[model samples]
Target: MNSWIKLSVCFGLCFSIAGCSSLSGMFGKDADYRKNEAELAKKLEMPPNFVLRRSGDPLVSMNVSTAQMLEEIDTIPSFRAEGIRIESNLVERWLVIEDLSVKDVWRGIEQFLASQGFKVEERRLDIGLLTTEYLARKEIAPVEQELTMISRLLNSWRDEMVDGIYDRYTVRVEEQASEVRVYFSHHMMTARATDTTTAWRLRPYQPMMESLALYRSMLYFGAQQDHALQQINTQRVYQEVKEADELVGLRLAATLNESWDYLLTMQYRANWQVERQQPEQHLLWVKIPQAATADQGFFSRLFGSIRTPGLVGIKLTPVSGSTAITELTLVVEEGNLNPKQRQQILTDLGLLTE
Candidate 1:
């Protein structure tokens, strides 16, 4: 196992050279992250016990940008993988969600997030991530209001493998009242047996549910609970909300595609479609190009290109899904209703959502 990891990492390092191999004139061709790990660690205050517990193949990516990936590359076990640069804009746009309690996972996330200096926060939602970005901006409506849109968006994602969000609802101490309450209402969607994981991802088979029909008797007339607005500038509050909501798409990206491909490959089934009303102000659900996609040969091809430490791609429609996810529901939780702001968010994420 140790030998195999060493080998994989070595090969990965070699491949990483595609971005920038010999910076001869730039730095005399001898400078490298590895030789400087100790000095870098002192400057970065990076802890050494990071990769101690891992005993298997250290994950890696395709051609990556060394300068772009250096911060993360430094802390990642130094187990030997070639460095490559990730798109800065993509680096600038990253998110991750995890169960959050796991120490190893949290530690890794913390270290990586710090190295990247992303504007990160912890919430009740099940996500953990490290990003080398500073591009996201958020706006909000209400926690309950946010949930409504998220539920609706999930429903639409099933129909279209595409995912997006033009607006957001988030609850943080600064964003929401110190006392927060969330209400969830699910919209039922049928999942064709695409794969075990797809079935699981669609409806949380990990936590089975009974189709219990429930209802609310009254309309949500804005603030149901009373609290002073603490000198809150609605405009500033609105801007923060928009920035926070922007993360939902990036966080959910990996799960969208991963879930779809894994499910379909298990069977010979896969298909979906998405339509966006506008590019800047809308979510465009794109079809994963059929000809451009390919089948994985072994564990290498299956997981090889998956080494992006930032936004692991979304696991979307499972093989169980007889079609691709095409119905992109752009839930604008809050916006100027001004077309430009909406368009920028969609365009940046490159979702077929609008």
Candidate 2:
């Protein structure tokens, strides 16, 4: 009876120490410390026979089970991947929402734009393209009911009352392996004072305005919480590469049809305005704009100093792969692009992957 009591006390003490160590291991400052504690807990299964007064065979089995439970806790996702994340680069930004389908994002975008007072002028779900009608400057924001004379005068100087200023937004959606990439393009229009009618011409793109629009969209997506967002273990199967000759292209794990649809939808995004697409020849003639200037907060001119609208060809070819797996290669037509210019163009196209 005494021996049993001593064993009970020993096991009780062991459990108390193990529980505290396991809790501390979860939030220790150093990773090594947690690892060592886990190892020590596993070793506790076989408490010394001298200390236990008898062989601790039962205690050994219990320790193994406790060690496994602790290890399972470590497999949980990191805090960042647990929820939606708003990420951005120089040219574009995207949200990482786990387990969200392309269709879900498409619907969310339409609802978001409408909520922001943008009338959906056109929508094509089959191709996943959405364009908003030009929203006048006045309708873009709520009107201030009361304005002092000094404030009104300041508004005049701030171009707040400029006539015929309006903005248009376009959203592009592309499906990645497990997530979606959303791209937003902003177009502006100004009414010519000389015209008798209301005619609006395309205005230059503003980086700040574009970023603001995307940020708002991300907020809306997070608030909806319609789909479950969690971390997914995915591989980098889609990649873009540049050849020794300075030609740029993509090596995707998707088939020709999948790649075609993705590229076609992406044309509406950013400044890659599509002129024509020829699926037969697997070629597309696109009008890519020159880089923005210092006034726009980006470098000037992409391919050359003389910036003019011209057609650039994009072609896709099937590499080698099985029916279930497809390997497609993307390449530029390389019409008049010099070696240096080709390298620059490749770098710009690489941003498409992001």
Candidate 3:
């Protein structure tokens, strides 16, 4: 038989009436088809020891639980994996995939970049470094929309007239044991023209863009662990424990590393700026700003300088046990607070004591 005839026969045999949605989930753009794909994507949750198997072609497989089936979905990217986590550093947000090898994450990143329309400028798998070509994208301004349709239409058009910006990024992947940490750095560029030619010049660094790209990449990683993480009971209210004569600041129902990450995440969520952090010594110095007064509007609260930011001292100590738990201690260096009031402050800031 001819090659075309044999291929056609194979496809016809693979896509039977019972398995037609599998094919349409990939190529079909209709509303119902896309909805089906989104539904399938939502049902996918990878266990920590998940395995992928492919015999011949995955599209022809009848198993609904196959990893290949989930990979075929073309929905918007997300980071909903079981062991994936997003962390904020001094200037950037990063991804930490637990129990995954560096090689596995490297491939996932390459696939993610290709799916996001990024052209790979360079790649060194040995060094776990990837660089992408500069991409030009329009800067969109946030538009406030009125209730009326005409008002919303005008605002939408106004958003289109916003300025353009270019960004280039470098990603570094570091492997620790069975886990990998991915960090991103963004470099901005501006258009420059002389009498002869137009070129792009590197602009000053924009930390905001670095954060934005990191978040967008998190979506591309599609490893959301929110539900599973919540079910793990690894988070807990802070507690004051007496270790000998010293009163420990807090205690957590997590390991030492988990406690550190949780503390950093909590600080980031609370908008507390880190002044100094020493992981080796388990100490962090952060500027905790006072709450905005009722008179301070949104713009003022966002743009104004911190008038009475307090310098807080945080320390962590791991308790010895099979189950991971850590002791956290908090102290105010420049404020006057009694023990009762200090506990109250931590409680008011969502650091509950049990």
Best by TM-score: 3
For residue 132, give model 1's deviation from the true position in Å: 12
Q: Kindly give the number of clashing pairs for every candidate.
A: 70, 1, 10
Query: TM-score for every candidate vs. truth?
Result: 0.17, 0.36, 0.40
Task: Specify the poorest-scoring 10-residue window by lDDT in model 1.
Answer: 205-214
Superposed model 1: Cα runs more than 4 Å off: 1-101, 118-350
Global Cα lDDT for candidate 1: 0.28
Q: Taking the tens digit of each residue's C-alpha lDDT, what string does model 1 give over 1-354?
A: 999999999999886784364564266654565767766665663233343322332432344445656766654442111111111111111111122223433343334334333334443334322223222223342333446776866665434332211111121111122211122122122222444643312211100010010011001111111211211111010011134444232222223344233323321212222322233322324343222123212222333553212111222222234333222222433232233333333332233122
Task: Residues 237-352, candidate 2: write the lDDT tens digits.
Answer: 35556667454555656667766665565454445667787899778787656422332322244534644325667676777655323333334444355544444443344323
Descending-TM-score candidate ranking: 3, 2, 1
With a 3 Å backbone cut-off (N, CA, C), the pairs that clash in candidate 2 are 45-60
lDDT of 2: 0.58
Error of 3 at 115 (Å): 2.6
